[model samples]
Target chain A: MSEFWSDYTVRVVVFGSALIGAVSGALGCYAYLRRQSLIGDVVAHSSLLGIVSAFWGAFLLTGSGNKSLWVIIPGAIVAGLAALLLTRAVTGLTRIKEDAGLGVMLAIFFGTGMMLLRWLQRAQPPIPGRSSLDGYLFGMSAAMTSQDLWMIGLIGAAAVITMLLFWSRLKILTFDPEYAAGLGLPVRRLELLLLCLMVIGIVVGLQIAGVVLMISLLVAPAAAARQWTHHLGKMVGLASTIGAICAAGGALLSAVFSHLPTGPVIVALVTLAFVASVLCSPSRGLLFRRRFVVD
Target chain B: MDIAIETQQLTVAYGAQPALWNVNVEIPSLGITGIIGPNGAGKSTLLKAILGNVPRLSGHVTLHRTDEAGSAAIGYVPQRSAVDWDFPTTVFDLVMMGTYGRLRWFQRPGKREREQTRQALQQVHMEEFADRQIGELSGGQQQRVFLARAFVQRASIYLMDEPFAGVDAKTENMLIEILHQLRDEGNTIVLVHHDLTTVKDYFDHVVLLNRKLVACGTTPQTFTAENIELAYGVAGKQLLSRIS
Candidate 1:
């Protein structure tokens, strides 16, 4: 217990997770408003392919198999954006709807990523950071370094700043896209900006929560916050706060219990918050609405 | 009479099917103009084409007031069902959005804008609901809120799509009064209206449409049984009989 409190690695991991949680949660509000929650899941899953591709590329370029965050983050962003574009193209060009397009993209990209990871394992000599590659699936926060924390902080700051700067435009775009376009706003460009932010948020979460559980970090906090407030500004603020708390708490609980994995623990905490919000939030909550019966 | 809007062979399509075909019409300035048609008659499509909301297959719409800033000359009230009512926003905040077009990028609504929003809400009799969440309002109140938003824009030309649909009698009367006030103040108001009975009473000028222009003239001159029949097919004769 004393060692856990003093360990710098634990401190870095917790901070990194908190930053990842806050950024994803805040950006997730727009996705939720746009009814594109599944897009977050799609982006997270597709980023796995990006990670493996980055590793392979690094191996090919340097003749050394080092999993650098520099290469991995950019690769994840590219893959996430590509997946989004593919989904858009499928929906726009074909008769398929957006949900079906998202489903197709999610399955194909994740399946391809898994195949690439397995092939990399069998095809190459034991890479230096190859063992930790599995960590990107389920996450290994215990192994996060100060460098990971810096990367998370940089990406998180960028996302938050961009959201603040374009707050009104994004709000209008999310709530009434057609009206925004009619008002002479560059609706397509604003949408692209939001998608880029979502991709960046997902990329930042990859090392902390991993592909499988990252969507929960992106969506759950916003969902929970939405129950408590009807104002978008308040919703974004509350979601960021909730996300930071949940991530830090989960990291601490996982630290206390060595058997519990950090990623799943964080996801469980977020789920609990969402459930509580659904059951107990005022005005809109199931229990409150039933008790009050006010329309 | 000055022409506020002129469409020159305006054609719009949804995929291969044309929504509006070769719509050539002139909307007079400084009065209430009704775009009356049946369902799927391109009434709404005409307004959208004028506003550049839909892609034009051919031709163009020219606004007479070329000196006005981009989109600032027009205020649009979309259909009630166009936006999600359950969106998380207050009445005041939504109304402030009307001022966005006049503002520079990254500039938020300020004191003057707030005052205008307040005045617009007052005009719609929605001042009391300023703080209320949009979803909490009744359907009539929601419609009034959208009107307030459009009013705050203060555009010279107003285009409304089914603004009276689903509203209470009181809201309808209030909206009609406001429209009369705007018209008297020399603003051009065009509405996509379905009720043929109110066309004569509500508007001075009318455009009868059925995917193409059936008639465009003063209401008394254009709102005739023959043109109504042309726009609404055989059923319009019966409707006209009922109206007369």
Candidate 2:
């Protein structure tokens, strides 16, 4: 255990997971409050297509396909935003509800992503990044390098700072969008900003939590924090802390165990935290054994 | 009287069906104006369209605010059901949002903002509930909270959608009093109102609508049985006997 702790690779993996968790957790609060919790799932799943499209674009442009995190992050963002905006547009312009539209986009995007992934794997010359491509699906945190850590740190910090700068508008927009617009805040642009931020947060974390398990890390911490506080400020602060703890702890466990997967471990810890919060939270818990039922 | 708002060929549609069409009316400044109509008469849709809450298929709404900075202070109180009540925010924080219009980019609520929020809450008699979560308030209290938010805006023009719905008589009277106070201060107040019995008493000017403008003038002149019948069609026949 001490030997692994001393290993630079393990440290990077753990720190990277923590950064992803905190950003996803804080941003997830607005989605949770707005009842758009499933958006993260949609974005994460749709980003698979983005990752493949990006790799193909690189392969087509240059002889070598660059599977670099920077290239794929933008690609994932584009795909994720497209999916969300398309869903909103369909919901607004037609009779299709947002949930149905999201579901449809998820299937089409992910289906195309899988098909592209298969084509990449079967390429005669063999794509250089093809072997490690599966890492984006279920994550390969064990392959973390110092470079990955830097990307996560810089991207995560920018997302957090953006949220802070737009704090009041975002809060009003989340709670009452119509009133916010009447207050003269640009509602559509603000909504787009939030969508872009959500996409960025999800895309950045793909390498740490993977597409399949990313939504859990995004939602669980915020959901759990909600049960403990009635204030948005406290809820956000607590959610970030909870997310960081569960992520770091899960990453450490994955590092110690030779065969355990990093994404699933981190996901399970956050889920457990949510369950505990629901059952035992003193203010708004499921428990009926309150020391005093003031009501 | 000066005109605070005028609609020229204002039309709005939801998909293929038009919610409102060819709505042309002038809302008088410095008084209470009632947008009286039945269900699906585009009463709420009219307010929403004017505020750009709903997309307009065509036409325009001209606001003849005495001042542009004052125009930016257009305060709106949406219906109780418009927003999620269970959002994690206290009454103080929610009411403080009214000052957001005046805040510059990257600025936050400061001591001045806090004091304004407190004063607004006091005006609406919601100061006691400042610390409570929004969802914890009663329906009427929630309405007052929304009103406090608008009051904090200190605007020259106020647009409210059904402020009296689902509230007790006491709350209704209090809300009426606030409207009277705002009106006396030379602020133009427009409300999407349904109750015919209170229409004449509550508003100085009224716009009777049914997808189109049935009547638009002073309440005593335009809010008549004949116009009500035209706006509501056959259903309005039943109301004519009750209101008259």
**Top candidate when judged by DockQ against the true structure:** 2
Per-model C-alpha lDDT, please? 0.85, 0.87
Docking class of 2: medium
TM-scores for every predicted model: 0.94, 0.96
Candidate 2: tens digits of C-alpha lDDT, residues B1-244: 7988888999999888899999999998878999988899899999988788888988998888843465555789999999988788999999999999889989999999999999999999988889998878888999999999998887788899999998989999999999899889889899999799999889999999989889999988998878989998898899988876
Q: Candidate 2, residues A110-174: lDDT per residue as tens digits?
A: 88998999989898988787878888898767777777678778888998999999999999999
Off-target runs (Cα >4 Å) in candidate 1 are: A290-295, B66-73
Best by lDDT: 2
Q: Lowest summed lDDT over 10 consecutive residues: which window, candidate 1 chain A?
A: A286-295
The top-ranked prediction according to TM-score is 2
Model 2: per-residue Cα lDDT at residue A58: 88
- Where does candidate 1 clash, by residue pair? none
